[model samples]
Target: MNIQETQINFTILNRFMVLKKKERLAHAYLFSGPMDVGKGETALGVAKLVNCENLSEENYFCDVCPSCLKINSRNHPDVHVIDNEDGGTIKIDQIRGLLGQVKMRPFQALKKVFIIRNIESMTIESSNALLKTLEEPGGNSLLLLTVSSLEKILPTVRSRCHTMPFSALSLRVMARRLMSDDGEFPQEAHFLAHFAEGCLGRARCLKEDKIFIQKDAIIDQFILSSKSEDFVKKILTDKPKTKGLLDILLSWMRDSLLVKVGVEDARLIHIDRLDDLKFFVERYSFFVLNDVYEESVKTYKLLADNLNVKIPLLIIKEKLRYE
Candidate 1:
């Protein structure tokens, strides 16, 4: 398989490539990151690499090999993607069934790979049952758990697996590959890349939800919050969306700082509004600029911590006034 294919994570593949070559691949792995960041695809790629019928001289898989084809079609008998059968909750029974399978040998491949999605969805009883498999994995067997949050996972389970933490994609990376779920690309893909915090899957969700259409209006709110009490009142009524606005507004301030420091346009998140970015850069001195940026960051954190959105947002607006 070509590891460099778009949507596949190359950094992760390369790491696994080295591990596989050295014969040091762990039997269990915990891929912890945002659900939308291609963790599942990475697991499948690793599975293909380990079990491919023919590994190239350079050590990548042949895409047309039987193992590769079976994995691509989800028909590989030994490579299992376990589901949360109890209506989004993995019950003790499902994990017990998995343990039984784990003890058996691979049907065809070099190793059996079981991928369990979002360990957070499993109950305490279910997780405890899973621990047994981790403690004593079958020979030539692998378990891959894609987790939403590390803290939510049982510490015993978390410690047993080799953890691979996925990072959000950069703006430049996202802008380059801006195709959406329906295969339609957008003119504001650069902005969407920045807006979704560079998680392509989340960017697609934001696109479908029409959050892109509201981008300008959100920025306008940031700009007008300092000028009109009535506008601020209207914005406060939609507190949930306002949380998104704070993120955008914080990004705006951050871009403005980057612009003033002569950072290249490519590095700035607000490149779509270059003229506007330049306009804002000239409005504040560096000291005042950084002050607001730090405050906005703290404000965004406060909102994320589940505080009343209006309070921190209003505090940010007062800071945005920047006396």
Candidate 2:
């Protein structure tokens, strides 16, 4: 598929385009954003642009050049893409090997591009070893690093690269893309997009998640069940995995808030349960809902910190019941 038409907007990709046009492209670039937001695709586009033989004024690759064809086929000699190996970690040995290859000259194109996907997977030693090459990048060699979290990288390495921050796709945009692709998912798309918390990749994941349907059913039961004691106990005891359940509950609460405010453009991650969302909004006040949302966020943080999961789950259920 053409990069522009892949449910992502290249019109907004002008920032990189201008850099390429100015002939002042940075030797190293860090594309950091939410997962599945097209960082890897953007990096490939950059590589193709740098190596295109018959470049146009508006576009990067000619799509017909030998180099572009090689890149398309994943056999480009000058373009190297380093990713995780068997254990999904970029080892020191892999870094050393890539650095060794960097010493050699570009054979085909004016520039040799190296794209490292998931730079956060690099070990401390590998990252430290790469610092020198990053600081003093070789002539005709460009490095493209991508990570979901920039803080995971060493500050020294981060300082040497230009950073591009990608935001989550808006609900309207995501919904439109889904409708265009599969009309059956129009309603579900809007809900999933909102629940994804501005992440298109997460939205896609939700579309395929079997647990999402069950989560919707659970939220419905939670909203309607009058016997708080039995309901909370059943839910908490039945699903020992409270963290995931908490995330879903948070999403449901956010969806309710969006529905209450009549937010047409709300990117709801749990779109499949619009009926439940509507019911919750009708039953709860804004203040109460907002409090629940805030507390859920705290619970998420606590879960991340390895706190006792059952305590937060019990507290959340009690708060929902009493307040």
Candidate 3:
């Protein structure tokens, strides 16, 4: 979908549109929000709007224009997406390469735009290098940095750019968007929307994820693993092979924790499995369950940093089994 048809209401989108009309857009902006909430997409939308030869009267991009088409396809020479493509860190070399490109004038569009995804992944050297770019970004150049939170970015970097905060998308908005596509079930839409934690991008990805194939087995193993070592081992083997496993595990722990704390059923992510989740929660003390949840989060961060996943997986298993 194009920028004009966004389901979630983004304050930044309206703010930028005003800036575009006033011709007072900033050189650098920090887009801070939860993952998959469309910070990156919004940055691209800004690029399209600023460069489109035929912007609509409603301040939307004419997606048919050459600039909009190239940006949409991520082939625009003036629009660049910088992310951690090598190893797990955005290295200094990448920043240097980007700076070299930013030095040049726009090839076709009126403004050159750079959208940096997961800017928090930048190494110390890279972050330092980015400071130079942020401080002296060229007149016609725009830098858009997206991170889960401002705490992840350097103070110096954060101070240099206008910060735009995004919150989780509403459940109704996300579910409605999911159901808009043909052949999607309403029941599945409700579940996917909650499971995505208010992120439309995550909702879409979850709809097609292969890990859901093991849902029943995984849930059963999680419930049984409290007493059976064999079940725990099976869960380890059955864990999602992708990074998405952490999200699934976190969701289960979160649901159990919510039940243990007497959170309302309506707020539970695993509403459909409330009975099973309550059963599981009853088996463990609140402190133990909370510790496991904290450890799981730490393990997820380590895994994202390119550490071996098996060690953390075993650690989590042991925590769940004996803690």
Candidate 4:
């Protein structure tokens, strides 16, 4: 696909064009952003642009050339993509394999490109192994690393490469993209867009998730029911367990704060829960909403740290009741 047609819009494209014009592209680059913001697509586009035999004045690939066709089919010998293997981490052995390949000359294109997705998922040993390659990469080879969580990446790895930050797309742009594939999405597209918080991947995932629908219903119940007993019971008995309910509640509370503070552009994962959000915002003071938001964030962090999910939920329940 052409660079312009990608889901994301930013100065990166223009910068890339300028760099290509000057023939001064970086040997290694780190594309950091939230998931589904077109980082991978952009990386592929860069590869195609760099290697395209038939290039246009706009610097876009002809897409009709042999090189472009090979890249599109993911059979280009010069372009290497390294992803997680068999649901496991990218190990030191895998990095060693890639490093071996990098030593070889490009098979077709003038430059060879190695694209690594989810670099944060690389094991510590693997990251250290890759550091040598990054420090003294081959002259004709380029490394592109895509990561969602920069914190998980080794500081040494992060410092060696040029960094590009990708932000989430606007709801309107996301909705438009979704509409192109599924026309029926427009009405609910805004809602999905809000919930996706600028990440197209999350929006698409939410669209396919029945849990989001159930969460919407639960939020409706929370708004309609005077007593929290039924809502709590339904949450506790849900198929995915209380974690789903807790997640939705946290998202709702976040939206409540956004709405209360008059933030015009908030990425709420539960856009359909606006009524519930409104109710919460109306009933609770800004301070209370902020506290709820903080608690929700803490709960998410605790879960990430392997803390027992029940403890956080119980604490959240008690806080809600106390408030």
How do all models score by TM-score? 0.75, 0.80, 0.77, 0.79
Clashing pairs in 3: none
Give the Cα lDDT of each candidate.
0.79, 0.73, 0.79, 0.75
Expressed as tens digits, the lDDT of each residue in 239-302 for candidate 2 is 4345557767777777778888986343555555566567667766788888878888888787
Worst 10 residues of 2 by lDDT: 4-13
**Model 2: CA > 4 A from native:** 7-18, 85-88, 182-184, 221-242, 257-275, 281-295, 318-323
Q: Point out the worst 10-residue segment of candidate 1 by lDDT.
A: 179-188
Q: Residues 1-323, candidate 3: write the lDDT tens digits.
A: 55535533357777887898898998999988999888888888888888999987765677898999999899999999999886399999989998998768999989999988899999999999999999778988999999998999899999999999888878977777778752456656766888777888887777676435555555665534654455445544643442555676788888888899898556776676777787777767999899889988998887678676666666776776643
TM-score of candidate 3 to 2 decimals: 0.77
Which pairs of residues collide in candidate 1?
A: 1-61
Give the alpha carbon lDDT tens digit for every residue of 1-323 in model 1: 44554456778888888888899988899999876888888888889888988887676577788999999999999999876765489888889888888979898999899988888899989899999899989888889898878998889999899999998898767767775433445447777787777788887788887775566777765654456456556766776676767767778888888888988566677677778778776767888778878877887787678676566666666755745
lDDT-wise, the better of 3 and 4 is: 3
After superposition, candidate 3 runs with Cα above 4 Å error = 1-10, 224-228, 237-265, 274-323
CA lDDT, candidate 3, residue 188: 67
Q: Which candidate should be chosen as best, given TM-score against the real structure?
A: 2
- The worst-scoring run of ten residues by lDDT in candidate 3 lies at 233-242
Give the clashing pairs for model 2. 191-268, 191-271, 194-267, 194-268, 194-269, 195-268, 195-269, 196-269
RMSD in Å for all candidates: 4.4, 3.8, 4.6, 4.0
In Å, residue 50's CA in model 4 sits off its true spot by: 0.8
